[model samples]
Target chain A: MTKLLEANNLGKRFGQQTAVSDINIHLSRGEVLGFLGPNGAGKSTTMKMLSGNLAPTNGQILINGVDLLEQPKQAKAHIGYLPETPPLYRELTVREFLVFCGRLNLLAGKPLRIAVDRVIERCGLGDVQHRLIGQLSKGFQQRVGIAQAIVHHPAVVILDEPTSGLDPIQIRDIRHLIREVANEHSVILSTHILPEVQMLCDRVQIIAHGQLLFSDSIDALSKQMHASSLQVQLANAPSVSELSAIAGVVSVQTIADSTFRLHYQPDNDPTERLVSLAVANGWQLRQLVAEQHSLEDVFMKIVQREENSKDA
Target chain B: MLNLARNELYRLFLSPLAWVILALSQALLAYLFLSHLDYFMQIQSQIAAIPGAPGVTEMIVAPLLGNAAIVLLLISPLITMRLLAEERRNESLPLLTSAPLTAAGVVMGKFLGSFAFLLILLFMVLLMPLSLLLGSHIDLMQLASGALGLLLLIASFMAIGLFLSSLTRQPAIAAVATFSLLFFLWIVDWAGQSGHDDAGWLGWLSLLKHFEPMLQGELYTADVAYYLIVTLTFLLFAIRKLDNERLTG
Candidate 1:
């Protein structure tokens, strides 16, 4: 797959405070990349530079192999940005705003109308297209913001806090729209919500204090989080003495009849042997599986691990 | 470039602030035109009585266009202040800046939008001249030249306002700064009368100096060129402001 965006040594500084430092990233088409960072981790800064809203204080941005500084117009044509605030004109109707955005990209005549129409439908904004943006709910306003960004058919779509002000239902709706857009457009989603990344992103980059803590797929991230292990529940219970004898098994609890939960080291897969032992012990083995570690837990454990290491 | 220009025009027209400004400017222009014409007529009969009012022709044309120019200068700032400033405040500018259109194109597009609104305001004052000199030999060529000069004058004022507007995201600050800057430049030339030749540099630099000769139906190449240069320079500066905004915003 062709990399749609690459950042080399990307950094931004306001006065003496550096917001981002020595960042490197490569994104390909058809990938939904989550940018998970604590507040002020430079996620928005990086997205801003990528989207051409702010020029990088240092380093370079390459959009579809085109240098952003050398060929900004062409590079920017490849990206669509929804800033942290959604950059909306409250006075304009959603349709009018999208049409204006279409014109800004120099798309006009039949093509502009078509692009605007396509985005409105894709973003599920058709219902409120004629409503003034200020009159729309936060959910619809965010949709309008996304519609404006994609109205020109950019290859890379950067969303900063796309679901920030949204309720649970609205968040789900917007997430669905984003994933749908990602089929045709690469996406960069930045937010502090870890589960959001797990639900929407194919790959995740966790940033903290201007540095990346980890970058991998959701499954890989959960696997790499070795400190915070999951507690598994099985319908077949091993004898109390049998459970205590299993190596690397810290403890086991018989929460329900014929049910046991085991806490073991994350890397060691003891589910099979435990089940086999239960079978040998004449305990009917019904279910034996390790609970998946949530992205939020993995994220916090990784962050805490880093902080502890620093403290040491 | 054209599409961006058209969008800017649409944005301006759709804004309630734009209509309010247009109406207010039109009313002000209409009032000033009639009042200036009344003053002109009141002094017209007096001019014929005097053995020779040294420069009656200049006197006839100067006050009308001069007062009209003043009113436009005052209102252009309020109208043009929202051109780019509002976009930035409303966070809608990123949509335009990220477009393929050059910054110069966007700036010029907005300038035209605000200037078009000013044109409607100017159109309201057009009748004042026709009302006063119905069938008299009112020198239509002079009238046309004065109108051309006024248009250019307003265009430059709008450019100045737009440049100031681009410097900030606050519409109120943009409006106030544009008004203060334009008004200062407008009257700065009058300050020249109290000083010697060495102190007249500021007056010559003032926009009023470039516009004064045009109001009298006299089109000096230097004054015309000055206004054009001022308009272009400020417009270019406004474009640069947007270019920097992409980095700083």
Candidate 2:
């Protein structure tokens, strides 16, 4: 896959404070890269630099092989950016604002009209297309914001917290819309929602304190922090000491009088041994289920580890 | 740049503030036009007896053009205050900066947008003087000269307002700053004539000094050049400020 965007050694400093430092990132066509970070972790700064809204103090940005600093107009033609605040004008109607945005992106005549129409339809903004943007609800305003970003159909789309302030259904709709956007354009979305990454992103980058702590596929992140475990509930359970004596059980955590969590190595299958032992001891087994590590667990672990190293 | 300009013009006309300013300005100009016409009629017989006495053009039209200039000076700041400042306040500037637009293009588009609106106001006021063409001998040549000078003056004023707007995110601050700077330049000639034996460069810098000659239907290249240079300087300042914002953001 060809890289649609690339950044090397990106850094930004404001007076005495460094907003971003030694950051590198890349995106390819038809891919969704989730930028995950906590509030004030420099996610917006990084997105701003990547989208050409702010020039990096150090390093280079290349969009579709065009150098951004050297030929900003040409390079920026291939990028669509949606800032955190949605960047809307209160007076203009939804269609009018989209038309203005389309023109700014250098589209004119029939192409401009077609582009505006496409976004309005794709973002599901047909009902309020003639209403003033100020009069629309927050959810509709967010749709307008997304519509403007993709009107030009650039090679890359950079969105900052695209689903930040929406209801659950609106967020789901935006997530679906983002997936549709990713079908034709590479997307770099900055968000802290863990499930958003798991459900929509093909790859993920986690940043903390102006630095990247982890970058990999979602499955790889799960594997990096994976812990194999089993949840077992029996009518009558063995003591911790007796369970530890089981051949494949490494450790056991008691949840209640009849339920326990058993941790074991990947090389061993503890369920078979545990089932046989339970039958021999006349323990009526109620439930036995295997569990995999979730994205939240991995995110917390990675962020906590970074925080610990910084403290040290 | 034309596309951006068209968008700005569309939005400006849609704004209630722009319409309110337009209606109020025309009402004041019409009242002044009628009052001057009445005064000119009273002095008609006195002027016929004297040699090369002042005509209606001198007594009525000249002062009216001068009033138009003052009106533009006062309202140009309000017209241009929201050009770039409101965009920043609304956080919509990124849409332009991140597009395939140079800083110069964005500034030029905004400057021209507000400049075009001021021209509309100028044309509407010109209609009052144009109505007098049927009743008496109107000095078309002198009227043209005054019109030219007012156009140049408004261009310069809009440039200053646009430049000030680029310096801050608050439209109110930009309006106040622009008014203060233009007002100071309007009165700077008094300081030179009051105390100094020679009215030097300070007098030259006075906006009225250059504008007064043109108002009398005297077209000097130096006066024209002064307006052009001031317009270019402020426009360049606005473009430079926008460029620096992209760099430092």
Query: What is candidate 2's lDDT per residue for A78-132, written digit by digit as tens?
Result: 9999999898988999999999999999999999999999899988999899999
Q: lDDT of model 1 at residue B225?
A: 85
> TM-score (chain B) for model 1?
0.86
lDDT of each: 0.79, 0.90
Docking class of predicted structure 1: acceptable
Error of 1 at A90 (Å): 1.9
Candidate achieving the largest DockQ: 2
Model 2, residue B52: distance off in Å is 1.0
List, residue by residue over B1-249, the lDDT tens digit for candidate 2.
Answer: 988888888899888988998999999999999999999898888789999998878888889999988988899889888999999999999989989999999999998888888888989988888899889988878888889999999999999999999999999999999999999888888979888867677889988889888878999999999999999999999999999987887
lDDT of 1 by residue, B1-249 (tens): 666556666777777867887777667766766665567668877677787563433455456677778777777777877888888888777777666666887888888877777787777666666565764546666777778888888888989999999998899999899999888887787768776677588787788777766666678888888888989999999988888766665
RMSD in order of candidates = 4.8, 3.4
Output DockQ, candidate 2. 0.71
